[model samples]
Target: MRAEFFIKSFCRIENGQVMFNGNTIFTTESEIFSNFSKETYRHFEISYPKFFKMDNLSKLAFLAAEIILKNENLDADKNNIALVFSNRASSLDTDRKHQKSIENSGSIFPSPAVFVYTLPNICLGEISIRHRLYSENSFFIFEKFNAEHLQLYAHNLLRTKKAEKVLCGWVEFDGDDYKAFLYLVEKNAEIPHTVQKIESLYYNE
Candidate 1:
């Protein structure tokens, strides 16, 4: 028999606001992602110094994951929890910054710090380090939020016993625009981890 999976909880971040399980958690007047992220970090009193140095992609994903993960009793399953993330912009936001450093004809200096996050998966690393999740992790780039793929992937991971729970969502950031929808998948919850359900929750206002 196949094992069933459920969405235990979820969080969203966009337009200078943050929401967890459909409730408003934080709001800010700062439109710039950089400023808004910092405001949220302080608001939540998250004590991670490396958060400030992360690129926008990492910051956004990390915050959404942090909120959704913190609420759940993940202490026992921390090591067994897997991460599955998708994004439309990939690492373009940070890629642009890295490009600028080398693009300048007058000064051709590439920063190792900026260059480190050229790949989209770096955000996964940030989340993993923050929550100490040491399990399967994957980042996919899609033209849009592919709920079906995410649902299927989580199902396989859970049914196969590869993960006790899965943290999956779409987190996109480009220039000054950004959006994140992170949810935790486990064997128990009110809602089934279906593609339709994932789509509805992602679009839920």
Candidate 2:
């Protein structure tokens, strides 16, 4: 059977606020990733200690994923769910940090912790590990948000039965400016997975 995809739920994090399905559930006055992310994590009551250790890029993605998947009741065989994520910044935010750690220091020491997240896909791995999902994952870089590319790729994954559901969208963190718009796509739901619809949700200020 040809599968039809729908958005099960969506979450957006920007302007120091976290919104899920059009409702703002959390907010902070601090914009710094260190303070804002920690405050947001505490507000959500997330117990993941590793969240503190992650780079800004991963923390932004991880917190958004937490809100998107909060109410989901997944079974052991979650390999059917895939993560399809894209961002314009790639890993530049972390890459800068890693570079500074070596270049600014007299001893020229690079922290392995910061270096690990130099790849944009590392956030996907963090989400997969947290949820224990062993499914396909892909990360794409674009000059800006490409709704058509995301919609087409996610729909194809479902249509081909490569993934029963997909968590897809944009998660970008460069410097202190950060935004994440993530949605859970499934076989059937109220919101059809159309390019226009995804773009609307993404650009929905």
Candidate 3:
């Protein structure tokens, strides 16, 4: 039998608020990472101290994942869950910061803490560590949001038994511009996982 997938829950973080399932959970005047991310983190009562050390990209992805997976039973068959994420800017937000640190005359040393999150996949690692998920994961870079690509890959992962559930979306952070639209996909839910549906949910927000 072919596998059927449905969207379990979705969250969108943009326009100075974090919207989950069509309701705003967090709002702030500051949309920049330094101020907005911290506010949202505190609003959610997240105790992860390491959150401060993460770069903007990781912070955005982590917070979005936290909201979606908050009430999920992640420990049960954790390896059966997959994380598939995409972004247009890759890690340029942090990459530029790392570059400036290296090029600065006062500080010529590259910080390992900052260097660690230079890859876009680092966010996936952060989420995996938090949920103890040792499953298939991938990060893609696209010119823009590509729902077709996301739908195809996620559905293939589930249909091929690579994963039972998939956490997928676009998390892009470049300077003051950032957005995270993440959703959970599972077998047989009310929201069918379709290309048009994903695109609609993403752009309509």
Candidate 4:
């Protein structure tokens, strides 16, 4: 059997804040980092001016992806990697906006551009396109994320040699509340295969 790279390590939204390595990143939603210092906030502002402009769902997905990328410590210089993201809301905000145009406004016929983002999986496409990842890509949504299903699909991908690495997770945005936690799982023996263990990493609160 070919050697599968281990998960190596992972990170989380520690203590309900956007924290990594014990330092808080400016996060507005959780209120955990409501006391972030001026210097820290400035750094985030400079590094991600566009981040603040994104809608809640986009922001959540982007932040989750960033956390995964940072923790993986892998080079993203190439476009061969794959990103498989599954979410519950499925661009509901985007749909709401576009639907208003179709339902309420007669003159502003809905644009196809806006319609494309309505699918639940388009968020995966957005992330992949942003990172130039063109490999195996998919987006799925169940009534809730099925841990057994996710594990089986992940294992099948690695066993079939589809992706060198995969980024998968649950990201949901409903109104002001959002929860996103992603994992970088590859073919590895050290990782846990049981659904209970994997599912525990998400939704700590």
Top-scoring candidate (lDDT): 1
lDDT (Cα atoms) of all candidates against the true structure: 0.90, 0.89, 0.89, 0.60
lDDT of 1 by residue, 47-127 (tens): 999998998899999999989878866674446889999998899988888889888734555688998999999999998
Q: How close to the true structure is residue 191 of candidate 2, measured as C-alpha lDDT?
A: 86
Give me the overall lDDT of model 4. Answer: 0.60
lDDT of 2 by residue, 1-205 (tens): 4336789999999998999999999888896778999899998899999888888888999999999887887776665789999999899988998898888774455688888999999999999988888888999999999989988898888889888889999999998889999999988788888888899999984
Once fitted onto the true fold, the runs of candidate 2 whose alpha carbons sit more than 4 angstroms away are: 1-3, 106-109
TM-scores of all models?
A: 0.94, 0.94, 0.94, 0.72
Model 2 lDDT on a 0 to 1 scale: 0.89
TM-score of model 4 (CA atoms): 0.72
**Can you write out model 3's per-residue Cα lDDT over 1-205, one digit (the tens) per residue?**
4437899899999878999987888899994568999999999999999889888899999999999998785665555789999999999998998898888735655688888888999999998887788889999999999999989999899889998889999999998899999999988778888888899899863
TM-score of 1: 0.94
Off by over 4 Å in 4: 1-6, 9-16, 19-54, 71-79, 108-113, 188-193
Query: Candidate 2 versus the native: TM-score?
Result: 0.94
For candidate 2, give the lDDT of residue 100.
87
Error (Å) of candidate 3 at residue 126 is: 0.6
Scored against the true structure, residue 95 in model 1 reaches a CA lDDT of 86
Q: After superposition, how far is residue 24 of candidate 1 from its true place, in Å?
A: 0.9
Clashing pairs in 3: none
